[model samples]
Target: MSAPFVKEIPTLLSLIQCADSLVKNPLTKESPFSVRVAWFDDAAKTQTALLTHYPRLVKESFYTEFEDTVQAGISLLNFQPFWSIMLGVETSQSSAAAESSATMPDSSPIVIPSVAGKDSPPEKSAIR
Candidate 1:
């Protein structure tokens, strides 16, 4: 028998794109947040890099309150304004297929992250 062939999952870049879209523009009424995932052979290094790269975010109330950083990351991604800079894009969209299947969705999920220097209350306050 011949060796089986398997297709590769989309690249991190593609994943980021997908995440950016969902974060940028939510579709369903209940599910609004987006997600980003990173894979690595070395889990420790990946965790280190994430913490090091976003120390402020990691230190903020939102991150501190959450038990899992992965969930924190997902929450952060939902923060509307900040998500834009992470991807350097105007707006984003979630995958239609994924949105349809989701359950236990977030109510009033973040649509636009608060912009810096704006009158909006800081996101940090939301956590408290």
Candidate 2:
């Protein structure tokens, strides 16, 4: 959301790499590690996007605990329209498995703050 925050992407990636290394055992080939992320694109008309393809070699990782937490909070405040981004580690068989598992059900209801601004407009339509 801010310039300073955007600059921390590299650092976040490093932390995620470290976490992945800690979670994945070098001796166990079955327990490979990877990072999965979801992001919102204004043009897409969808709230999120996930990694659909795997690169020949995956090298970089991105960790965003604070960012994700903040986004989760914002989503709650904004009536859960969607989150800006979400980051998580995957130790599954493949990226597809990770993507499937990361998706949230549409029926879930997210709670928002009870207080509304005095100047805020009245609700014209009920939230489905």
RMSD per model, one decimal: 19.3, 19.3
Residues 56-125 of candidate 1: C-alpha lDDT, one tens digit per residue: 4455443443324433444644643443343332111222223342542434432323345677565644
Residues 5-110, model 2: lDDT tens digits: 2232233234334434433412222322231111122211111121223221123222233234334434534523333222222223333444454563344333
Model 2's alpha-carbon lDDT is 0.31
Worst 10 residues of 2 by lDDT: 41-50
Tell me each candidate's TM-score.
0.21, 0.18
Once fitted onto the true fold, the runs of candidate 2 whose alpha carbons sit more than 4 angstroms away are: 1-50, 54-70, 81-128
Clash pairs, candidate 1, are: 21-92, 21-93, 22-93, 80-112, 80-113, 81-113
